[model samples]
Target: MKNLKVNPSNSLKTSRLVIRIFASLITLFYLIAFVPKLIQMLLGDAPERPPGADWEGSMVTVSFLIFILGYIVTWWRGLVGGIIIAIGSILMFLTHMMSASGEFEFLPFFVFSGPMLLCGILYLVFWWKKP
Candidate 1:
């Protein structure tokens, strides 16, 4: 295979563009998933508490904010934000499991953590490839 390039500068710019695209996608996904929850919290219309202060939801909120900050920093920090997002995802998964076993089927784990986990995995993969 030919390692063809219009020029080294073009190749570098292309690489940066790819990274930025991935970062933006991650940011957009998080924003779409989290903004509604934050609005609900602000409007004092947050969902019903899940037995114990809704720690899972709280983590999701905090991790989303951290991810936003990470986007402002560097992609590496953004990767850290992805890790926080993954933590939130894990908490959400646990909450769902607990809620299921507690004789009730309730929780918004799918909406709350699904994107977090997916974006975390996607960005983590990108971060690993980044030099």
Candidate 2:
């Protein structure tokens, strides 16, 4: 077997590619997750709204829009997009954590937060060193 040398630029490109893909995936996941709820609400199939439901729903809608915008920017403006995604991911992770009780389940938190955080960090690192 022959030893292979890795080029730093090539590695960086690879990392950026991975980050872009991850961002896209996260955006897709959010779309998939939210569209059903959105349709349900529109169709009046959602459960009865509690107090402050409108405010909560509005916030969620805004956040999802922001996430989509961040994802689109990630392909062009890495650092800014990364910060947006990272902040969103952190908020989501914290929300899941706060909602869990003694019988906590890790899957929900991990599913929502893991890829966003990982790719966001990678994008930040790569973009930070670009210039």
Q: Where's the lowest-lDDT run of ten residues in candidate 2? A: 50-59
RMSD of each: 5.3, 3.6
**Candidate 1 lDDT, 16-38, residue by residue in tens:** 56656765875787677667766
For model 1, give the 10-residue run with minimal summed lDDT. 48-57
lDDT of 2 by residue, 1-131 (tens): 99999888888888778767767777788888878777787788878662226654454455556667767778778889888877877765665555526444589657766776777788789998783
**TM-score of structure candidate 2:** 0.74
Q: Largest TM-score belongs to which candidate?
A: 2
Candidate 1 backbone collisions, by pair: none
Q: lDDT of each prediction vs. the true structure?
A: 0.60, 0.71
As for model 2, its CA RMSD to the true structure in angstroms is: 3.6
Deviation (Å) of 10 in candidate 2: 2.8
> What are the runs in model 1 whose C-alpha is more than 4 Å off?
1-78, 100-107
